[model samples]
Target: MPINLPNNQARDDVLAGRPALWLNPNLKQDGIWDTKLPVRPSRVSEAESNWMLIASLLEKCFPELKATGGKIESALIEVSPMREALGYSSSEFGRIFVKADNDLPVAGSIQARGGVYEVFMYAKALAESQGIISSEKEVDRLVSEEANALFSKHTIAVGSTGNLSLSVGIAARALGFQAVVHICSEAKDWKVDRLTRLGVKVVRHNADYSGAIDLARAQAEADINTYFIDNERSQTLFFGYSAAANELASQLSKAHITVDDNHPLFVYLPCGIGGAPGGASYGLKAIFGNAAHTFFVEPVQSPSALVHMMSGSSEQVSVYDAGMNNKTEADAIAVPRMSEFVAEVMKPLLSGVFTVVDDDLFRWLWIAQTQQSIRLEPSATAGFAGPKFIVNSPQGHAYLEQHGLREKIANATHVVWTTGGAFVPEEQFTKFMERGASLVKDS
Candidate 1:
């Protein structure tokens, strides 16, 4: 099948690395809430249960988890100050909140939700299969010497541009499992150094994220003792991310927020290969149904999910095929291609995707830091553009009118899911702040 995009303009804009918004024409209001998808909402409950089972082990291993009793979660904070700084009043963009995954415990990034959960799930399964801990009561024995020895005989592997590697490597090493991270060239030196310091083997790749993942998967397949956490097709990883929706639902309820027909909910997630955002969108749709509209944010040069989904093709497509260089300051999400599994799952669920330039990301980063004291990396700030696109753009107005949401604009709730930055080194963070300040001044 050919890559048939809806418009030549969008194709050209994407190829030229110019920011663009691509809405999903295949988005369905009905039947998209099906529980039989590749990763179901019910699996989210199971993932939550699994997290509880390993709570004790996580607490023993990671000091950060001690305060939360081993629960991997982040705050849903109201960013009124930051929202005002963006120059949008309440009536135009509604109440804005930031899903602060940047400050998540342990991994200090959104990958803590998926990458850490996947590692924990694998360890629990391996222990149970080997009769090391047959019951939930004995699950704490996973940290014991006997279980450590068994875990030492095996390895957990993943390929990432940055954050996922940190989450997976940190969790795997904590459980005494040998960890191997195949990192792409775009991955930051700080992330690589962090992983190496944790005693994890770092395999550097000269290619992009997809290439690193391919080589990692192939290498892991040859070694029976090694388990590859495939970001492209792993249901475990997807389910791990889906559980965050449940957390968000609870938070919304506690905050006296109402998400209904009149008071709609809009969530903007920063996307990479699409696993994190796709899983979160799926879970959100399952809980809030048509009331929740989810959008994915991507770098202008690395809009892998946008390009592939916009093409309306099941066949995997790369940004390179569209003449994109896939280079961006948002290193973590500089993916050449998206996860095919995620594209298929999001076909009917995703509302749309929008691209952001690196400069805007820097400007938003500066605003977030100065106004609300929120520290975020370039990739994480991509979601800040979501509310403006939804409220101010012509395409956005059309979508709202089509969905009868034009009258409901004032009552909407918007959440910008920030992905990472907590673990950014002080010097690197200073550099980010400087660049952001310069960009803000020039703007």
Candidate 2:
């Protein structure tokens, strides 16, 4: 609660998504990363070795979330139709495509997986610290009974770019918590209204995602009873996302992809608030050690993280642990600040580099449609945009050759991670289904 939450006056009129005449910074030669984040110790821990934390998750978080039934549902497709242009399929690897059915989720956001687990984890931890439980398990079971019994009595708050925030509201409601999602005015009014109808207290902040986050964080600090489930910064949230990577690795096993030492994986993943990649990177590296390589992708327009990486003031890859700032977006992946862990725990994960892509987001959408058969939102495309830009660039092409990046991925598999926008309305879907097709007549 350092800075005051600006009044709601004229906040409703804040124009977002438009390019501003802000001071521009150099985009190459470690400019963004070096300027924004100075190197720090990695906060990520190695696999299964952190039993105390794992046990805490079981005792404090999962128990309640499990009791509520699967709040984080999965949606699966036979293959992403959009993958057609890219030329890949589940059939390529011999009929092995066991994956999380993300389309089955209520909000079409995988963040639901982490959000629910985070709430109970916080509750369990708070209770334990307050002497409600001498150990993690007591709080774990108590969280289940307590969450189910009076979930509605408590209020949960989150700041998101549609998916992550929406997931928090839906999961909170199911678990009996009064959900509140704070969003920037630049977000689609339709999505904001939908949240309101769901009984989620949707607060439209004058600023972008980062501004809303500042508001949410301040509010959470002031009110003890108000539980905040930050998909952006909390330690528990990382563990939650690690589950997704774990499941993905399990699926890769069915494809005969040996995830062993020397056969390490070079995963190019999406970053939004740096939660998924940070947590997943930590998890993969922990379990696989030298057997895994993870590359984080950010949007060129929203290079807050890259900026931090280059700056000397910050300790990690993001500013979340410190605070938030004015934010820009590719929408879904827009975040002004990031979890401090990205600097500390997730810092050692510099095994791979970070890259941003051009604005061919919609093209990637069509690519998703034609190739993998999944219609991802523009923000989702931001993830793919990174690798696409690299492979397409002359310098990047040379770098790839120099680093042997083009080496035919041996038993190598890639997950583009179409991260959000799974539930586009019928009108939107119709538009997506016919995005770039030409009419033909054979008279």
Candidate 3:
């Protein structure tokens, strides 16, 4: 049955998570993507310092990272071939880049940046107060018996669909914190079992991501010893994610890619509740100013952030309100509701948002693997459709004309931020790939 909703037609359509493109009418006119950053650069720098500590800790504690000399950051692999397969023209889109946070070390997703950072921030603060880690060198203390004992006295908890839980649970358990992950019902069983094997408490909820988050918040409030990693409202998480822009900027500079009035940059990020994309967009805006056009991509079944921003409802409206189930194979980004904090911050920072159907994700996944030797999970593949949509879609053309971006289109650089996939169990990833292959064969 089609959903009969009680909003205006546009709002109803958005809430239903129909595949669509929406330009932010509230985007600042005089300075494109030039808004006051939600968080300060100093705060972002602090998060970077924490990552340095984490790097040191990994060197001393984990043999795997230590063997690689503790190189914690993932590469921004260039995938111009993948872009060509996706129908991006080199003459029009200039070039295509892929920021492969999908291959991030440890937790193997973009969430590793924020999720692990939040856990580290919490653990570091508690340890510093107890004089357990007085210096960066003492970061190794986290893996020590005494520090583990201290961490065991505190509990770290979060709610996630999958990726964020892997990051938080793995890091928290490594540091000996009693980690509790409240997972949405749709989360893969492999993720749950992996966390359980790490000795983290995995609590499964028979509801959507929002419901799981609500329950996790209540539980954290009930226990003083429990420190909740608030995905929706954590500035720490946002700043941790914001740090990526600096690294990306360096990469672009090294490649001789310029972002200016003539050479514009377009970034496509896959979004869920919007923390990671929002933070990254904020940082990119700060770095590239008017030269960067940032857009978020979402699954058609759960375009939570776009629907909220477009309708001006923020957290008050959900996909369910439009009679949508918020179900999709992109489990990591299957959020029903947008984070109010991110929605506010993203209003001025984003260029636009677009939603893609599950079939589109699978098609691109197949194309990427066969044509470009690149493989990504369904959620990560959301950004693969961005360049084509921005250049070819009617709504996209209108947006460019309205924003005076038509002239710069020829010199635009598109970057697709692939969010997560590396840690997916081989069998699970094979299943995703098989589905993608079958879809391609049928087509």
**171-195: candidate 2 lDDT, tens digit per residue:** 5665557888888765766577777
Candidate 3 structure quality by residue, lDDT tens digits, 251-345: 89998988887788889999998999988887787777767789999888888777678766534567766566788999999998888888888
- For 202-256, candidate 1 gives per-residue lDDT tens digits of 9999888999999999999999999999999998888789888989999999999
On lDDT, who's better, 1 or 2?
Answer: 1
* TM-score of each model, paired residue for residue: 0.97, 0.70, 0.92
The best candidate by lDDT is 1
Give lDDT per model, in order.
Answer: 0.89, 0.53, 0.81
In model 2, which regions exceed 4 Å deviation? 1-84, 87-104, 123-149, 260-264, 312-329, 351-359, 386-411, 431-443
Error of 2 at 380 (Å): 1.6
User: What residue pairs are clashing in model 3?
Assistant: none
Off by over 4 Å in 3: 1-17, 29-38, 67-71, 135-138
Output the lDDT of residue 212, model 3: 96
TM-score of the candidate numbered 1? 0.97
Pairs with backbone N, CA or C atoms under 3 Å apart (clashes), candidate 1: none
